[model samples]
Target: MTPTGDELLAMLSALANPLRLRIVAQLAGGRDYVSHLAREIGISRPLLHMHLQRLEAAGLIVGSLELSDDGKAMKYYEVVDFDLHLTASALAEAVRTLPPTDQEKP
Candidate 1:
């Protein structure tokens, strides 16, 4: 289903953070454990988890619980889809809302 404006905004907002973007990019590779992501992204485990929860809520990613060989439970996350699937209008709207770059400043 096509996302509504608010949904789009939430998704965009979730992605606005640099660390979140990195998380999405990493998830695009394949399913990965939260601990692995935290280490790779260089963010504290708690902070990374907070960002991940937001991303999951936005439907940008999904997490599944798994049992490791050691019998420890772990949560692994993966991008819902390989593509971002933003509509043209959404892209245009987002671009319009962006602040002017240095080149655009007088």
Candidate 2:
């Protein structure tokens, strides 16, 4: 189902963090195990899992349990959709809410 304006805003807010953004970017490449993501993104496993949970709550990503060749259970995460087309109004709203940069600060 398509998300509403409020849902989009909440999702965007969840993604506004730098670490979460990086995690999303990495997931965009392909599905990856949580541990692998933590290693690749240079964050702690617990912290990565926390961010993953937030992303999942936003409905931006999904996770599933998988078994490795060595018989270990792993959680893999992937972007829910490769094509996320935001409405023009939503895009405008997002742009308007961006934080001011150092140069733009009063």
Candidate 3:
């Protein structure tokens, strides 16, 4: 399937941040619960949640809520298989097709 301009923008935006990149790298190793992920990445849970939301929205990650043995719902995050092989020409073409962002508006 062809990717939408918005999808490409969102994925790029999500990966642009250092924290989010680390989150992606950590999730790459294995599926992880939020608490453990935050601790391992040296970030707070809320902050981690924000980054996870962006990644999830961008289709770079997937999250599922499951009931644990204690009957508590735990959210687990895993990396999605999105091998983006972007070349300079492809990126330029994509950018050429992008509608003007807010900053470009008068």
Q: Estimated TM-score per prediction? A: 0.77, 0.75, 0.84
lDDT of each: 0.86, 0.86, 0.90
Candidate 2 Cα errors over 4 Å, as ranges: 82-106
Error of 1 at 82 (Å): 6.3
Clashing pairs in 2: none
Candidate 3 stretches greater than 4 Å from native: 100-106
Estimate the overall C-alpha local distance difference test score of candidate 2. 0.86
Query: Could you say which candidate leads in lDDT?
Result: 3
Q: What lDDT is reached at residue 60 by model 2?
A: 86
Error of 1 at 31 (Å): 0.9
Candidate 2 accuracy as TM-score: 0.75
Evaluate residue 105 in candidate 2 and report its C-alpha lDDT on the 0 to 100 scale: 95
Q: Which 10 residues in a row give candidate 2 its minimum summed lDDT? A: 1-10
Candidate 2 residue lDDT tens string, 1-106: 4455566667878889999999999999999998889999999999998999999998889999988899999999999883557788757765656666799999
